[model samples]
Target: MSQSRILVTGGSGRLGQMVLDQLLHAGVSGIITTTRTPDKLGAYASLGVDLRHADLNDPQTLSKAFQGADRLLLISTDDLFSGRRVQQHTNAIDAAKRAGVRHIHYTSMPEPEASTAIPFSSDHVATEATIRESDLSYTILRVAWYAENPVELGLIPAALRTGTWLTSAGAGRIAYVTRSDVARAAAAALVRDKETSQIYDITGPHAMSAAELAAALSRSVDRPIEVRQVDDTALARELVASGVSPQLAPMLVTTDANTRAGNFERVSHAVQELTGVPPTSFESFLVKNKARLLGATDK
Candidate 1:
């Protein structure tokens, strides 16, 4: 197989970093990554990755950064609150087309076309449409929720502290895939040979409900954790009280409401098929990050 000159945006980000590492490990040569600040990515440069300055909000930098790259991993920017993320993504797509990029692998949400309940889904749906219209061979990776989200956002820690997990998502199950697994899938897709646009629902092997998640947390931490389902209004109030911004509280509540409506219940084998490894389960993720979940510092 001929090696594709790969360029990845958001390479310094959480998931993007994982994708970069996976590409390097897979021996994918001629890899390039773009960052607004090249000095911040000196380590990647030392590893022989071509680091360039490219900002999604700045269209002039994108074409030069994408020059000579056949495949581009366009990691979606996390500017949901500003309502300009879709525009930024469209800018990237347009620049990729102008630079003659052949294939684009985008990180999108699972089944964004099915629901308008998730506020961020609109950005992804619009971006996917733009990519389709760009005449580029594309791979749309519809990723599931990350297992690390709950732990990183203080949800699990709050439950551990209060002995109760408060949720507006009643009886809704999510097939949570870890960030590492998603990155691996992205790496696989970037190098694979394909003639047509493909969409992959990158999800975990199975789905688990809120109650099941609480029970798993209890078992992992060796404590009793209770599940409390509340309405969106009550959830929003609690979120605000817990230091979440007043403006963002309602969005979080809506996320749970969407979950309860079963928008995140799809499970898929795409992770294994793409990365040659099964997606990590929620139970295993919790066990692996037990110290972090239990508020213990790494030694």
Candidate 2:
């Protein structure tokens, strides 16, 4: 199959780095990767990747960096609290247009417009609009909550220590997809010979509630973890008291609120359809990371 120069923005990021690896594993060449710090991607450069320095905050950099790229993967920016994420995204979209990039790919969350809890959801809503309004052939991957979110945030560790899994989701369920799986699906979309305007909701096979997830955590860590549900306000208060920063506590609380609103309760075949392989189960993901979550084990 012929290859076009596929440019992956934020190539040094967690998801973007994984997408680059998947692209290489697929033997897809003519790859262009952009990050703010090009020196950090020495390994990818060694693999014949065209590394460029691009910053979403700087439109001129992006315009120059995206040159000659047929496809572009705009991994959503990570400025959760800055409130400038949408503007940053717009800069990239405009840069892609200036560079004349044909197809654009985006990573987004599910039901952003319906998300009353997450203030950042509007950022995605605007980004999607900008992408569509650009008239570029695009693929939007509405990725679900990452299974690693609990672990990446301080939640899993706190729960394991206190034997109390705290949440404000009530009975809300979410299909938490893994980061690698999301990355694979995004990569698969970019490399396809038939690119078109499409949106795919990438989710795990099963929708699980906080209790179910707590049970999984209990089993993984070999401990009894009891789910402790509270109101969103109370949860935020407790989170801040437990050492979470005031800035981030609200965002964490709202994830549960959004879940309660049924924004994330979904199960889809998009991952399997895109990658030709069923996404890994949540149980499998926990088992694989149990060691890390558990920290040191008995020798």
For model 1, how does the per-residue alpha-carbon lDDT over 1-299 read when each residue is reduced to its tens digit?
A: 44879999998889888999999999888899998888888898888899999999999988899899989999999888798899899989999999988999999998787757887888999999999999999999999988887766656766777788888998888888899999999998888887479999999888888899999988987889999898988987886665555765665676687788888999989989987899988988898988877763221
Clash-forming residue pairs, model 2: none
lDDT of 2 by residue, 1-299 (tens): 54878999999999989999999999999899999999999999999999999888888788789999989999998987788899999999999999999999999999989986888889999999999999998898999999888776667776776678889999999899999999999899989877779999999988999999999888877789999999988998876665555766776788899999899997999999989999987878988998888772221
- Model 2 misplacement above 4 A: 241-247, 296-299
Q: List candidate 1 segments past 4 Å from native.
A: 240-251, 296-299
Report the Cα lDDT for residue 89, model 1: 94
- What lDDT score goes with residue 94 in model 2? 94
Taking the candidates one at a time, how many backbone clashes does each contain? 0, 0
The local distance difference test score of each candidate is 0.86, 0.88
lDDT of 1: 0.86
The Cα error of candidate 2 at residue 4, in Å, is 1.5
As a TM-score, model 2 comes out at 0.95
